[model samples]
Structure formats: structure tokens, C-alpha cells
Target: MTSRDTDATTDATTDAAAREHATATTAATGPAATAADAPVTISYEEIDGARIAVVSLNRPAKLNGLTMAMLRGLDDAAATLRRDRDLRGVIFAGAGNSFCAGLDFGSVLKKPMDIVKAFAPNPLAGDGANLFQRVCWEWRRLPAPVIAVVHGHCYGGGVQLALGADFRVTAADARWSVLEAKWGLIPDMSGARTLADHVGAEQARWLTMTGRELSGAEAVEVGLATETTESLDDAHSRARETLRELMGRSPDQLAATKSLFNHAWRSPRATFRAERFEQAKLLLSENAARARTAAMKKTPPNFVRRGTWAFGAKKK
Candidate 1:
């Protein structure tokens, strides 16, 4: 991104909060989205000039697989970001030993139809995207930049979720994969858009079909994870450092610039059009063939693991 104007002296804590207030403007413009309209359980940390929200999958028992509560949390966070007057940017990360393990298999096992329905957007019924998707999309809609820091395991839905951010930082040993194929599903959680931005159609097909895992290092190479840190701690530290640098710049300029770059990629019309084009092909099955086969056979999908674990690796 090009350099922007700012007051130079960054009162980050204050400026970011003010931007949140500006985002709040949407709250009044759009129809009221009551508690009933909320998605799920992701939580947040409101910063002065930005938001450092940690939207955890919260089901650590399920390795933080997604849930309706998590989805509601994502929407609520987006609403807050939307209504906020001073927010300038956002940071999307996760909690626990693993970032997120994707959807909860146990939940699916117990209530397959219900669980699947929850992930569906139901455009005809008014909701067009689910919580897992917004965790990624809302960040893109923000006028300011968003950064995702990944650690531990990020698979299936989780892998696709990170694709939404403007930048990402991943732990060197973090497990990465388009894991949905393992469960006889595809990356339908807004990942198609995010993944395509980084990789070509062919590469995207290969990654999703293989259910291939990637190291944090490999994630950066494939564009799923942006940067690989020696340790998770480093990923946070670097992200914070980058934020400080960004805060030092002008807020309006940064926000406007972010908007411009996003649009340069495509307008709302073009975006959905491309979405249809891609989904049309993927829905036909050239992509998920191998993943489905491997899942049913209960075999480990072909994936090349990278990274070495030495004693006490420093956290990024």
C-alpha cells in the first residue's frame, strides 16, 4: 500500500476508538439487527483507533471447531466495528493451543442436518453468510486493514477463515490445511473468494482436493498464511509492531487506501459474478474428488509436512 497522511504523533489508543464510532454509523443507516439477528459467540477487544478482536471458536473441547455461538459472536463483533466511530483497523486471531480445528465433528455427528443448516447463509431467509464466513469477510469490509495471526492447527473452515485478512502471521509449526475435504465437504465458508485472491484456480483445486496440510512456512508460500514466525509469540509481537507502524500513519488516508485496494480487486457486482463462476465449476466436482475419496477411506490425505520442532522454540 502507498504511504498516507497522518498527524505523525500517533495517539493510537484514542484514534482507533474514534474510527469505531464512525463505523457505528452503519448501525443507524441499516435496519435494526436485534439480538435475534446476531450470529454467534466470537468476542472482541475494542482498541482506541482499532479493534484487536479474538473471535475464538470457543469449543476448545472440539479443538475450537465452529458453532452457531461462534458465528453470532463474529456478527456482533462486526456490528460493533460497524458502529464504532474511531476504529482504524482490526486484528483477527484465535485462542488456546490451536487456532481452530474447523467445524465440530461431534456436533455434526449428533445433529448433522441442524449443524449443516447453521453454516448455511439462507439468503432467501435474509442471512446470506454464516458466522464462520463473517469472521473472514467482515474484516475485508472494514475500511481499515486487518491482520490475522495464526498459531497451532488451522484447518478446513479455519484455514479459509484466515484468507479474509489483509495480512497474516503464522507460527512456523502451525498445522495448515483445507481440511473440509476430510469430512466430505468443500471450502464453502467464504474461502473460495479469499483463496482465489492468492492462488490460481488450478492451485486452489489442488490444495482443497488433497486436504494437504501446510506448515506455517508453507502457508506463507501458498498465500494462506502470510508470515511464518519461529514461535506463536513472535507472530503477535510482529503484528503489534506492524500495527504501531500503521498507527503512525494518517488514519483517513489508511482507511481510504484500504477501501481503494479492495475495490481494485473487484466491485460488489464483479465479486458475486466471479463467485458464481467459480462455484459453478467447483460444484461440478473437479475440485473435491480426491478429498472425498480419502475421507471415506479413512486414510490420511496426501500432504507434505514442513518445519522442525526443537526444544522450546521462540514464539513469534
Candidate 2:
């Protein structure tokens, strides 16, 4: 729920580290690392940054599918981010060929019924946050901005996961999809909440319900992605180039601007006030359960037409 502040050191050192790691941030090398010192399981990378802490989700075999273990790691990473000064941002990326494939197939299969169950009146519980939201929310909650570099397949939970980051740079050919419906699931990993944060509700539903495929290029159009690069190498380069722009800003000025924009989607204040209610309706609807259940069977789910609001209805 809380993260510690990182220690201060020569900006030159942190800058060099950030450049070297490419995907990692400069916060890792600071005294804030004390929080990260905890004994941990699972493979992860921590890069110290003067203004950011870069965290990498390491299980390439599953395409970085999140597991309970990975969740715990994320918790630790968030904890390490608790209050302190000096650090200005956080960055996240996945290890290996893919950014994240979403939740592992076995994890989803274990509680096939959860998707149909009514979401509690509150999605945020014990931690005052939900794991699904934490996937992207944790990154958003930081006092700083979170930058994500996505490549390869960014689908379902994976895309939702990236939704948490403030900015994202992806690969040109990366394959993306909402896909939860295809697997009899919903974008519980914070996708539902954050989907409209960038893209609007209608677009979000069409993607979630139908589970159509998307390319990295389309992602930019849909607002799920920021820009596309030819490869990971280029993606990182652009990230650094963007970072250079960030580095020029006064830390205080940048922080304030980020904070203002971070909560720009505040419920009462967000423009989707009307759609938010409808979305909540669907989240708890029986129709959602039936639709999700069918998709899990690998059945082809019906979706609304791209420009039309019709779901499964005959072409007009």
C-alpha cells in the first residue's frame, strides 16, 4: 500500500545506471532499496535510478503471465516504493520476448467461477486496493509517473497491466488483444477499471466482449499504446529519448503536473460518469457471466460492430 523514498546520490551515477539498464529505472541504486532488501521469491530485476525505480516482471516461459508469486513480488516492489523523496518516477517492463501474456492459464482455470461471481460492493479490500487494479494502479499511485515498454504479445491482463503505466512504448509488430472473453474471463486485472481511463467505454466493451485481435499500431489508435518501434531495442531507445525530455523538467514542476493528470480520471470528475455506472452494471450482471462463461470454452464471443453499439446483432 505504501512505498519508501529512495536515497540520494550523484545524479550522474543514477543517469549512467538508467542508460545501462535501458528498461530499468534509476531509483534502484538508492537507499530506498532497503525496502527491496526483503527476501523474495521469483525472478525479478531491480535497477536503481535517481528519479525512478525500474521493475521487471521475469517469467518469460509463461510470457510473463502473472501468478500469486508474481503478485507478491509486485507487492514488494510497491512496498519498496513507499514514501520518500529524491525519486521522481517508476518504470516497468517484462523480461524475455514478451512483456506479459496476462494471468497464467492454470490460475484462471482454478477459479473459473470467479468471473461469474458478483464483484463485491468494493473491489479494493484489505489493502484498500485490488490486485487487478494494482497491476496498473500501483504504477499510477506512485508519486511519480510509471513508464512501460511493451513488446511482442500484450493481451488481456497484459494490456491491463500496462494500462497502469503513465506512458507506454511498444513494438511495431506486437500482437495485442483484450482476450479475457476468449478464455471465459473478464479483464479483472484492472483492465475494466482502467480501460476507459484512456479509451472510452464503448471502445473498451467492444474489445472486451468480442475479444478481437489488435496490433501495436492499432493500440496507439485505441489509446492502449503510445507509440510503436521496430523492435525492443528501438523501443528502449525512444524511452530513453523521452526520459531525456523528462530529465529537463524541474522535479517539483514535473511532479505537480503528473499528480494533476494522474487523478484526472477521478470518478465524480471524469467525463465518463454516465458510462461508469453502466460499466458497474455489467460488472455485476448475469449477462456478463453468461458471456464470460461461453468465452472461456474457447467459443467465439459476439461483439459490437466497430462504429456501431450493437453486440451480436445482425449487421444493419
Candidate 3:
């Protein structure tokens, strides 16, 4: 064949392959496979010389509804943050008006096999967490503290996501709900586990069964939120301020405390044992010495970079 003919054929082949790949992706993920549906975004900001990670859900037009891609994005973000020893804190937020309106069932239900894959446990990690659960649970496992800033609609999986954080600061007027009941479903996204840590069994049952919406103030009253602010900006500011305060302390202690509460809270013996173990390590660390020297000299503590310490076995 002529060189021009060969070039033309190659171009056509590439075009056909592109079309086939696009068609396959669309079929697998449904119509939600658009540029606008670009799941989650992660960025780092150096605040007061401490590196803080911010994870934002990018689907604002649909109220940041959760999709399979978004779930994987969240999991990936958590994994990335876990590896960063310099990370002091993390903030989870929504890009637009709402935090998240729960799972995008219409988009996800299109692929039954994807749902099955998401529901299956991770064989290698031995954590007993499926993809849906890991997206939330991984936040609890990170050495750095996580705070969820809730503003608009936070329902179903969104609520679970916030619960996974060490703290949740919400806009006073934001709507919060355990909305799984509304869809004739239960929260399978680790909400069942985290919710118990915050509230009483009766209260947990009421919220899960009724799926009643609560204002930010009400959420705080019922133990769903750490605190509420008058506006979205205020909520974020409060979260940042809290992180700044946390930055003043030793990162190792903060990590140890999180692990203690998350893993050993329900067992007094375990809590005591963990406290002693973690305290022994912290007391002998350089950061603790810096804290002591700074306190004695009445100067700010200049701590060394944090160490990644694994305290407990992975929990579901």
C-alpha cells in the first residue's frame, strides 16, 4: 500500500479504538461518566508550617452525589494521605452547595457487577472492609486527625463519612439525615459502627429508623456533629482553627489519642493498656522533649516531623 494509505488506515484504527474504549466505559459506568462527574479532588495547604490535606467532592451540580468513581476516589485519597508523614490534619468538604446527597443509585445501579465488586471484602488488607466501607473507615485509620465540614445536604453515606472523622463541624442551618431508610435501605457504609461511638443506642436507632432530617444545631444536640457555625465560611474557619490548636500539640500524641479512642474506647482494660503503651513511647520521643523544653522556656515548640505509628489492629 502507499505510505499515505497506510497513514490513513492507522488513523482510522486509532479512532475506532478510541470510540470502542469510550463506548465500553459509558456502558460500564452509565451516563454519569462525564467530565463533570470527576469524583473527588485532593489538595494540600501549608497552614502555619503544618501540611493539611483537603479532600473535596467535586459533583456540585448534583449536590455532590456519591458514585462508584467517587467512592474509589475517596479511598484513594485516604490511602495517599496515609503515606504522608508530614500530614498534620485532613478536612473533608464538598465543592458546591451540598456535602453529599448520598449514593447516586441511578448511576451505580446500572452496573450490577460493579456493585458486587464494591461490596466484596479486600482479600489482601484483611481489614474486612468493602470498598464502600473503606472510603469512610480509612479516615479513622489515618495517623493525622480528620475533620468533616458539613454545610448543605448530608445524607446517608455523607453522614457516615462525617462520622468517620475525628470531628465534624457543620453550618448551623445545614440539613443532616440518616436517609437510608427513606430509600428502604440501611446504612452499610460503616455508619452502623461509627454511629454507636457518638450517640446512645436509642438515639442511633431513632435516626436510622426514621431517617428524619436534623438541623446542624439539632445534630450537635443529638451528638451527630461536634459543633455548628452560623455559615459555611464560619464552619470552615472553625475547622481550621481547631486544626491550628491541634497543631500546637505533638502529632504523635494526637495520633495515639485517636487510635486509643477509636479502637479501645469500649474496653477499659484495652484502653488502659494502650494508654500506657502509647504514653511510654511519647514520653521518650523527641517531640515530647521539645514540648517540655518550650514550656519551660515559655516559647513555641518546634517539633520534628511526625512518625507513622500503627497502634491497633485494623477494625471494621
Number of the predicted model whose lDDT against the real structure is largest: 3
**RMSD versus native structure for model 3:** 12.7
Q: Which stretches of candidate 1 lie over 4 Å from their true place?
A: 1-55, 108-132, 264-316
Ranking by TM-score: 3, 2, 1
Q: Write the per-residue lDDT of candidate 3 for residues 146-223, one digit (tens) a residue.
A: 999898788888899999999999999889989888767788888888887888778899999998999999999999
Candidate 1 has what TM-score? Answer: 0.64
TM-score of each: 0.64, 0.65, 0.83
lDDT tens string, model 1, 192-293?
Answer: 777777776777988878889889888888777668889866787676667756654444345445544555467788766655654443333321333345
Candidate 2: residue 197 Cα off by (Å): 1.3
Cα shift from native, residue 175, model 3 (Å): 0.6
Please give the distance, in angstroms, between residue 207's alpha carbon in candidate 3 and its true position after superposition: 0.6
Q: What C-alpha lDDT does candidate 3 achieve relative to the native structure?
A: 0.76
Best model per TM-score: 3
Q: What lDDT does candidate 1 reach at residue 244?
A: 57
Give candidate 1's error at residue 279 in angstroms.
32
Estimate candidate 2's alpha-carbon lDDT, on a 0 to 1 scale.
Answer: 0.59
